[model samples]
Target: MNFHELLLCEGNTLEKEKGEHVFMQGDSDKSLYFIQTGLLKAYYTSSSGKEAIKSFILPNDFIGSLSSIYAGQNCSFSLVSLETSMLVKIPFEKIVEYGKKDIVLANNIIEFLMRLTLKKERREHEFLCMSAEERYLALIESTPILLKKITQNDLARYLGMTPVGLSRIKKRVQSKMSKQGENNP
Candidate 1:
């Protein structure tokens, strides 16, 4: 069964409106959430109050304070819905209980966490190696759906660029594609 199905079997679900916070930075709650519908963003706020988006969680994505759960500390980031969303809220204690009894469920959770970790590592490498334009282009190529769903400001923050920079990159890429299409046709 899929992650959603697993969560449905074991967790409590809730509906959240756009702009609602699932959890805030420094929150002590260690609940794990699986998105049933819509989108959410995880972000970190610096002491100077600048926000940096960590990731966009889509349907079936698992999110929570994994590090905090393991370390027994407060959550390090904040989670907020980008649209009206449905989520399965699984308490950390429940996960532990399920893991102890269900090998398949435990393995699936491990795989999911590993995939998330790899994706984060890849994004870090891309940020370190790619130019602003290249990063935007790569994101568009890899996750075109995000272009339709996310706000320009949020997208820019996720890409580690300014809104103006993202705009310029989009215009440039569009112009380049248009020119290439015309020449090919």
Candidate 2:
């Protein structure tokens, strides 16, 4: 069967209220979730109590801890609902087991992992090569709608800046845009 068909037949629908956790860092939760609706955040917390956001998951995204599922390790980050979320939850092992017998299903899972890997690489590149202001600009261009949905604090965290720094960047960007707008017209 196909991945979607497999999900329909073998997965379970799970509902999470706002602020609920799908799994926590260092936990052994091993389910892969396909989001149907709502927003979720994946984040890591340092032993010193600093929290860093890994990424935000939107509808149609797949999220899971591969380490926990495939390697018998604990989750490296926590997944939590930012809003009431609907998701299809499937055991990672079950998917792998089915994939062994279904070429299409196996390929689909491989494609999903590849996409996730690319996204991670891009995020790493952004942090390593882009300035804070540039990252903010890219985020604006890519997901402006997300700005309205998330808090400024979360936005700053995602952009790898303090809230104050983000506010300054915002002011600078707006000022530049305003000047350009006046000159253009």
Candidate 3:
């Protein structure tokens, strides 16, 4: 069976309101969540209580703590609804069982993992090789809609900069854009 069919057949639906947490750091949640609508934020909280945005989970995305689900360890990050969200929750183990028996299911899982890995890799590259400004520009090109949906502070955190720094960058970008527009005209 296909992944969607599996989810519909075996998954439990949840309607989470804004600010509700799907799972927190150190929680053992072996479930994968398929977002049907709305947005979720996956973030990490340091022991000193600073929060770093890991990524945003958009509609049609699957999110889960891979380490927690596969290694039987505590979750490394927390997931929360940024807006009211509808999701389907399925046990990772259940997916694995089906994957082992169904080639189609196994291929789907592989495809999902590949996409997830590419996203992680791109994020790592952005952190290691790109400046905050460059990352911001890349975010605009790749996920412009996300900028409008998320708060400035959260966007700053995701871009690995302070909110004040982000403000400066935005001003610079806007100034440059206006100049370019004038020049073109």
TM-score, candidate 3, is 0.95
Model 2, span 1-185: residue lDDT tens? 78899999989999999999999999998889999999999888989997778789999999998889988999999999999999999998899899999999999988988988899899999999999999999988888989998988888888887789999999999999989889573
Best by lDDT: 3
* Candidate 1 vs 2: which has more TM-score: 2
For candidate 3, lDDT tens digit of each residue in 100-126? 999999999889889989989999999
Residue pairs clashing, model 3? none
TM-score of 1: 0.89
What number of backbone clashes does candidate 1 have, counting pairs of residues 3 or more apart or in separate chains?
Answer: 0
Clashes of each: 0, 0, 0
lDDT value, candidate 2, whole model? 0.91
Every model's TM-score: 0.89, 0.94, 0.95
Candidate 1 yields a Cα-based lDDT of 0.87
Query: Clashing pairs in model 1?
Result: none
Which digits, one per residue and each the tens of the lDDT, describe model 1 over residues 14-96?
99999999989998877888888999999999899988898999997888986688888888899999999999898878777
Give the residue spans of candidate 2 off by over 4 A. Answer: none
What are the root-mean-square deviations of the candidates from the true structure over C-alphas? 2.4, 1.6, 1.6
**Leading candidate by TM-score:** 3
